[model samples]
Target: MDISLVAGLLALGAAVGFAAGMLGIGGGMLLVPFMTMLFTAKHFPQEHIVHMAIATSLATIMFTSISSVRAHHARRAVLWRVVKLLAPGILIGSWVGPWIGAQLNSSTLALAFAVFVAFSGTQMLLDKKPAAARELPPAPGMFAAGGVIGVLAGLVGAGGGFVSVPFMTWCNVKIHNAVATSAALGFPIALAGTLSNIYFGMKVPDLPASSLGFIYLPALLVISLASVSTAPLGARTAHSLPVKTLKKVFALLLYSLASYMLYKAFG
Candidate 1:
């Protein structure tokens, strides 16, 4: 790989990792879009750029999620009961989402991603109430929510935190606990999405040498390694800061990014 590309990948990885750690997002919302832009700039085939971006982003998240989960686990904040309840649905939905995504036109997927991001960001902004303490939902509801989250995660290459945290919070889970549990959910989402991407890419032609299906191994390696190193810092920062202000800021940023993505998708 070229030094310039390596540097860029590292920088992007670090930034995305920190944001993921701090915001309880999977970081794909940031990484996939940016990586798509990078692939386009590099003159990659337009048909494959977004797929590559999504696959690579999911692959990178495997390590980032591990780091984030470990940090949250160390704090004893993860709700393993919820994780167990939700895993089956998440695994199934995540596996299916990328196959559905691959069948759609790339432009359509981009537009959908933009709309979803905007909606999610707006929800975060509007629902700014501090998390209320309450009992976990019945297993079925949590499982259903997990399936929905997993599908979205696989379709858009997210860590599932954007949806998971809100769902957990709305279900009366504490904010910190929700974030921690969301971090754990990232593992299944990443695993499922990565495998799906690999399977879907098998029939595609003329892919880059380093690619495994839609995933670019070099990009995955660079980003995942750097993201893992930086995630702990983000986790620590999340623990220290007042999350309300951070959520608002992140919401605004997501809005801006979403708008840009929409423009790219439709223009």
Candidate 2:
């Protein structure tokens, strides 16, 4: 137990957690990279390194999402109705995502992650508005949308906000509502993904000590504790910023994640 290493993880968690709340995301976009670097430095096997990173990131998001949602809920921004409608499909899709992701090689997964993240970044940067008259889809439609969100989010190790926020806003849901609802959705996404990762990793050889399937306990403890605490701070900050500024920040953040994934994939 190196104090310095723990401190580093805590600091990293603080940064990612703040962004997760502020941007209506689960922080996997950032967490995955940070965890990957940590695992690499610890000399974990390359074959399973990315997988473990993603799994641990998802587990941490389980806590961060709740922290963020609590803050949003306080402000009366969360649309529980919408969250209910989207959750079923997200659950189902999230379960399937890790099964497939576990089968992919690190390079393939990294490339795919890059592509999806880049797409999310482009959408954030564009911030296109739907017709003012548009309305949210019916239940079936919302379910279908949730499935897409779940699969993409699971595959990319994301919380699904990059997709959900735009989809909700396009349906004429208020931006704040879209973000809060998306934060709520992160719970399901993280739950399903984390379970699947654990299942997938249970029998695998050479996992680091204190691992629960793909989740690393030491990293999980340090990162999650810091992230959960900071998430509220980010949620509070989210409300104070201008919408345009938020979108731009999200866009830039997504792009940076995408670029890092791409480099890891092909460089």
Candidate 3:
């Protein structure tokens, strides 16, 4: 790998890790567009750029999530019982998402990602709190919600925090706890999605060197290492910072990246 590319990946990983920690996100929304840009610059196979970006992003979350969640757990913020209830369905949905993604062309996949990310960003910007009377549903409801979130996360290469945090908040979960729990949820989503991407991508031809199916191994290694180191810092900041303000800033970032991805898809 070029020294400059490694440096670029390192910078991206640091930004993503901090955002993931502070926002209770998997950082995929940030990772996918930038990774797409990098892969395009490298002149990777045009048909495979989005797919590879998604795969690599998911793989990095597997590391970042672990680091972020550990910090949240130390603060006693993670809702482990909730995680247990939702995980089974999340596993199933995440496993299926990559197979569905494999059927779409690169442009279509990029379009899908852009649309979903833009929606998520809008939701964050609005910051509407759920009604006070609402509460978390029964286990079955949680499982179904997890399924939907997992599938979407898998498709878009996100950590599912965009959807999960909102859903939990709507169910009256506190913002801090919701964020922490969402961080915890990233593990299962990333684990299942990454494996599935690899499986589905195995059939594609002409992947770049050092690729594992759809995953660009070099990006995965560098990003994961750098991200893990900073995730704890982000998690700490989340407890002290003005998170709502930070989220608004993040929302703008999301909108810009999503727009860039939309241009990539159609341009």
Candidate 4:
């Protein structure tokens, strides 16, 4: 790889990592846009740019999620019962979502992704308090939410936190616990999305040399390592910060990114 490309990857990794740490968000929302920009700038085929960005982002998030989950688990904040209830649906949905995404045109996929982000951001901004429930919902409810969240995560290459956290909180899970548990769910999202992307991209031709299906291995490695290294720092910071304030700020950032993504899709 060129030195400039390597440097750019490192910088991208660091930025994504910092955002992940600070916001309890899967960095895909940030990483995907930046990766798409980079790919376009490199003169990569327009049709392939979104595929590469989403796949590479998902590939890297596998590491970021692990790092965040470890930190959350150490605090005994993850609700394994919820995870267990949601796992089956999440697993199936994640695989299916990417396949559906791959069939769409690049611009359509980007628009769908942008709209989801905007809606998620708006929800986060408006939510003022934890929902009335204080415990995990019954298995059926959990399963339904998991399926929806998984599909959304797969489509957008996210950690599922954007949807999962709020859903958990609405089910009466505490905010911190919701965040931590949502962090743990990232693993399944990443795994299913990565596998689907690989399967979906198998027949596409003229990809860059380092690609495995849609994933670019070099970018994945650099970003994963850097993001993992910083995730713990972000987790620690989460404990000290006023979470509601942080959520608003993060929501604003997401809205801005979502607008930019919408422009890219339409322009």
Candidate 3: C-alpha RMSD after superposition: 1.2
Q: What lDDT would each prediction earn against the true structure? A: 0.84, 0.86, 0.90, 0.82
lDDT for each residue of candidate 4 in 29-93, tens digit (9 for 90 to 100): 88889888888888888998888898899888888988887887888878888888988788888
Candidate 3 residues 172-205, lDDT tens each?
Answer: 8877888899999999999999999999888888
- Report how far residue 121 has shifted in candidate 4, in Å: 0.7
lDDT of 3: 0.90
Per-model TM-score, in order, reads 0.95, 0.96, 0.97, 0.95
lDDT of 1 by residue, 112-204 (tens): 788888887887788756445555668898788778988988998888887887777667777778777888888899999999999999879
lDDT of 2 by residue, 124-158 (tens): 78888889889888899989988989888877678
Against the true structure, candidate 2 has what lDDT?
Answer: 0.86
Candidate 2 Cα misplacement greater than 4 A, ranges: none
Candidate order, lDDT descending:
3, 2, 1, 4
Clashes of each: 0, 0, 0, 2
* Model 1, residue 1: C-alpha shift (Å): 2.4
The positional error of residue 50 in candidate 1, measured at the CA in angstroms, is 0.9
Query: Over 4 Å off in model 1, which ranges?
Result: 128-135
Cα displacement (angstroms), candidate 1, residue 193, comes to 0.7
